[model samples]
Target chain A: MIVDIHHLNFAYRDSEILKKIDFTVKPGELLAILGPNGVGKTTLLKCLNGMHRASAGTVMVEGVDILKMRPMEIATKIGYVSQKNEKARLTLFDAVLMGRKPHIRWRPSDRDLKIVEATIRHLHLQEMSLRFIDQLSGGELQKVCIARALVQEPKLLLLDEPTSALDLKNQVEIMLLLRHVVDYHHIGAIMTMHDLNKAMRYADSVLMLKDGKVFSHLHPSLVTEQMIESVYGLPVEIHNINGHPMIVPKDSTQNLCC
Target chain B: MHLHDGQIPEEYRKYIGRKFVFLLLLCVSLLIALLFSISSGAAHISLTDVVSSLIGLETSKKIEIIVWNIRLPQAISAMVAGAGLALSGAVMQSILRNPLGSPFTLGIAHAAAFGAALGVMVLGGGIMTSNSMGAVQITNPYLTTVAAFFFSIATAAVIVAIARMRGTTPEVMVLTGVALGSFFTAATMLLQFFANDVQLAAMVFWTFGDTARASWSELAVMSIVVTITGIYFFCNSWNYNAIDAGEETAKGLGVRVERVRAVGMLLASVLTATIIGFLGIIGFAGLVVPHIVRRIIGSDNRFLLPGSFIGGALMLLTSDTVARLILAPHVLPVSVLTAFIGAPVFLILILRGGRK
Candidate 1:
């Protein structure tokens, strides 16, 4: 396993955000966490990256305990791409180059630059490399962020709602990029996403999160209609399309709730 | 999408070249400003005589007093305050991730001012005059400046800590700083009310920022501090670039986010305190200089940081020169002139930012 979260419990102030959760991802596998809003998906990702410590359990990357390791050391092992806030205003290259910071001290070497350049190239971002992120479209920026993560050369990668504001084309592109990252880079990826269809299509494994704990952790093929209904808190219909699961609401309400 | 490619300019690619040039330029400019400032005061001393006095070749007692004893200190003080205040503001702006971050806006300057008032008005604050300029040896004005600066920094630290612990928004940072600054200003005013006539007058003028009383000895001490810190800060310029690059990105890159911000703030606060100790509360140098520099050199602190220092030194000197020469023998306080220049420009930024 590349990442191991054992009996995890996390809270913000007085309110508990995560509880007694056990999750793990094997090397080279793409694990997609599917859930409704406020279900602790992002929190779970933070735990794996050592951004937030688990109150009751432990998060281990590869064989090293995240709690015991220095944040810098953990950061080098598990690269995380997060939701971009307003403060980020640097150009794509400058932004991606920052990903090499964990490896180099005081200054970046020629080798670091080569690695960053290769990561950007691997994502086919040569055209948009010089552009500031804010100036780029959501899709382009998402790729830039992924490129930055890849520069870290980590065994594991974590992402939170990487396609939240993207258009349909972008949403598909980002998911495909993640799929490629897992297969080509042989990196273990754990992504939390709202789109069930996108998750089922790209994810080798799916983890259903409900009320701060993992409702189910299984292959995408094993998530039946009954399990989807139980986790989402609503009756949902499931369809198989080209060896992938398609989850939709039976209520024709258009928006699915879980 | 990228139009040109994100590759850094080859000139800036090697940190050594850009930073080295900036350091050399800042030193050269400081030297030139020092020379220009000595010659062009309210006094009618020729440029040639000013140079002669600076080199210690002049023997005329009156000319020596004018150049060495008076204008030289004033010039050096203005340079120190300009470089120190602007550098401090840039570092704070980068750390806090707010363009409006500065000692003046955050009320660090006011806290320093209040501490000065308290030292003078509340605790034997009057100048002891035996030498000219009513030498303030007994009062230890440096203590007041240092204390005020620290108080101001403490306030900022508390606010940042609270913001971090509570996960505060930018509006909260602004509101908190304003409230703290206003409270400190009011307290200083109350201190003034209880002060004796002479103490009150001294406190009032010092808070208003007059470099008229600057002496060579004081400026030398301040320059040493500014010089050391300036070199240290410019050395870590890339660390700042990493932070603004994005917090998660910085974190992923192994940049210690919390530690970086804390260390940056401490260094910036020290610069503020050093300037406040000697130059008094020179209004808006911190607030406006970086903003202006940002426009000229874009937002790369690698360039923007040192650029602001150079621009600030030139700017404050220009403003001080105008204040001195504009009225001849009847010189106006530099604080008022800085306000005159700073206010309208600050208003323009507000208007422009609003329009955009």
Candidate 2:
């Protein structure tokens, strides 16, 4: 398993955010965490990457408990991309090179530069490598963020709403890029997504969070309309189109929970 | 998304040539400023005379006293204070992510002033008459410096504490700093209200920030402190660059975000404290020089730090020379000329709206 979480619990002050969450991910698999706005999806992602401490559980990345590890130690093994994109003033090359901080000694080695160059090329950002990041568009900046994470060369990748700021075409392109990189690099990826259809199409498995608990954790093929409706508190129908699950929300008032 | 398919600038690719050229230019400019400052003083010493004296060629007795005893210490003190303040300003701006973040804006200057007042009251042997600048001469310079250093660090601690509680956002940090600065200013004013004439005169003179008071011994101590702190800042240049991207991103890149910020504040505070403790409050060097350097060379701290150091030295040395020569035989406070230049630049920064 590339990532293993057991009986994980988290709270902010007195109110609990995540409760008894348990899951495991294998290498080369893409796991999409799906939930409503306040269901603790982003918070859960923060916990797995050690940005937030788990209240009562353990997160193991590559068979080592992350709770016992320092932030720098966890960062070496798990690359994380945040939800909000900043207009960084660094050149794209330096921005990506920043990811090599954990590996750098006094200065960047030739090997480190080579890795950053390769990662930038892999992201198809060679043309803009010397440009300032603030000059890039939202989609380009998102790619830069991902490129920075990729340069870390982690065993597991965590992304929070990676496609939130993108348009539809950019969204699909980014998801495809993530899938391609995860497959080629053979690294496990866990991303929180708001688009249910995209998750159903691209993720190897789906984890649904509802009211700070796991509503359903299973393959996308096994997801049912009742499960979706139960978690979202809205009526929805699932249709199989070209071997992919697509959710269509039902228009009804009486079935809504009181 | 690229606007041009033009080849990346060769210098950009290598990361050595342009930066080297810029640094070289800054060094050359500093040397010119040093020579200009040393030669253009009231004594009317020729460049040859100044050069000979600097190289220990045994000039006349009057030339030696003017160049070695008075001018050299003042000129070098200006350079050291400029470099230290500008470097600290750049570091503070980066760590706080605020363009307005500097020793003055962060309350460190006012805090140091208050401490100086405390020092004057204690070391000047109580209520002093305002008639004489030398009447309240501090019995122990170290006492005043230590007091100033303590208060400056204390101010930084308060700002950091406020940041920690309210979140280390740029707005929060800047607001807390402004508030703390105002409070310290008010506190210093209260001290001045209660001060005797001599102590009041001493307090006022200390705040004028003249480089003439820097003796060789004091310069030696200031040099050691600046060197140690400057090297530490240079070594962590990459980490600072990472943090500039954003805190979460820096943490994701394996930087200890909170720890780095705290240490950065500590180092920057110490640098500002040591300089201000010796030279009094030299405002705007830290604030203005870094901004100018950032506009010219860009915001990469690796280049920005050295660039600010040299640029700052040049500005202060030039400004001090102007202050000395603008009126012969009597020197205006260096801070007067600095603020004359700095206030306008600060207003321009606000009007231009370039800073993020």
Candidate 3:
């Protein structure tokens, strides 16, 4: 297992955000965290990456508890892509080069530059390597951010709502790219996603959260429409479309036009 | 645009190289401004004479005295002070993530002014002269400087403490700084109101921010402070770059964002206080020069910090020279000229949307 969480709990002052969350991710597995807005999906990812301290329980990544590690140590073990990527005047090359921050002191070495270059090319970001980040399209910027995380060479990767803002084509492109990266790099990835069909299509396992508790943790093929309706408080129909299970609102009219 | 077998691309190399060239140009411009400033004073010393004296050549004693004792210290003061203020401004803007962030905007300058007023008014540092002009002078420069440094640092401490308690968000810091700046300004006005004519004159004089007030020893102190603080800033340039990306992103990259913001602000405050303590609030260089440099070199602090430093030195030296020559034998305060130049340029930047 690349990551193991047991009875994880998080709170902010008076309100508990994540309660007794438990899950494990194996190497080369992609886990999609699905939940409604404000269900602590983002907070759970933050806790796993050591950005937010968990109130209770252990997040064991390869047998080491991340809660006990410093941010720098955890950064070497897990890469994180934030939900909101800020637009700055920095070049794509330098922005991705910043992922080597935890490993290098004072100046980036030749090896670090090589790794950044390889990652950029691997993500097909070489064409815009010199372009400023503020000038890039949303999909290109998202790819640049993913390329940055990949250069960290982490054993685990965490992304918060990685595709919540992209269009359909970009969303599928990002999900496919992520799927390839997780499989090819032999790394564990846990991403918080709102698109249930995308999760069903690409995720090896899905962890659904509701009311600060886990509703279900199972393979996407095993997720039932009843469980989705119970968690989302809306009736949904699970349809197998193109050999993948997709969720559709049960209230939609089946035949509309003449 | 393919990478050459995992090698860094040549286009990226050229991009980095272009920023370096811009920085080098700034340095060259600073040197030219320095020589021009030294050569254009009332003594009619030529650039050749200035260069000769600078290199220890056989210049005349009178020319040497004027250059070494008068022009050189004032010019160097402008250089070091300008560099320090601009460095502080660059760090402030990066850490606070606000283009309006600077020591002057954040209340450190006003705090120093109030401290100087206190020293002149209550600390027995002001001399009340009975001459026809009713001249007032700071009889004890050390006392005033120490007081100024103390108050400026006290203000910084308060801001940092508030950041620690509340959080190091840009809105919190900037708002607290604006509130404190108004409070300090009001307090200084109150002090000026109760002061006698000599003390009032001395307090007002100290606020004008004349570079000519700094002697050789004072210039040396400013140089040491600026050098040490500027080096500290450059060492953490990458951290500033991360913070510019976003606090959460910086944290994910293993940067202690809160600690960096607090420390960067405190150090930048110290840099500002030291310069203001000696030179007396040279405005707009801290606030405007960083924006100017950012426009030319982009927001990479690795280049922006040094670029601002050199650009600031050039600006102040040139301003001081113009201030001197505009009214020969009677030097205008450099702060006035900095505002005159900085305000219009800043407006243009704002109108242009502050694009790089």
Best TM-score goes to which candidate? 3
lDDT of 2 by residue, B1-356 (tens): 11122333453556646777998999998887887788887668898998999999989999999888888899999999899999999998988878787998888998999888888886653344443433234446667777888999998888778778876666776787788889989988998899888778778877888787689999998888889988998988888887788878887777877777878887899999999988778888999898888766678888899898888888888888898888767778898899787778767865775664
What TM-score does candidate 1 reach?
A: 0.86
Candidate 2 has an interface RMSD (Å) of 6.9
TM-scores for all candidates: the values are 0.86, 0.92, 0.95
- TM-score: the better of candidates 2 and 3: 3
Instruction: Give a tens-digit lDDT track for model 1, residues A18-132.
Output: 8898878887799999888888888888878777777777887777888788877887888888886443445677677777767777777777776766677778876776666
State which docking tier applies to candidate 1.
acceptable
Report the CAPRI category for model 3.
medium
Q: Pick the candidate with the highest DockQ.
A: 3
TM-score, chain B, each candidate:
0.81, 0.88, 0.95
> How are the candidates ranked when ordered by DockQ, highest leading?
3, 2, 1
Tens-digit lDDT string for candidate 1 (B1-356): 11122343343255446545765776687677667777786567777787888887955898899887778777767777887888888887886778888887777777888888877765665563454534333356666665666676787687677666755444565566778889889999898888877787778767767676567777877788889889888877777776776666666556677777766666777778767766677877877888876653456676778887876776677678778888876666677787688778877876875674
For the second chain of model 1, what is the TM-score against the true structure's chain B?
Answer: 0.81
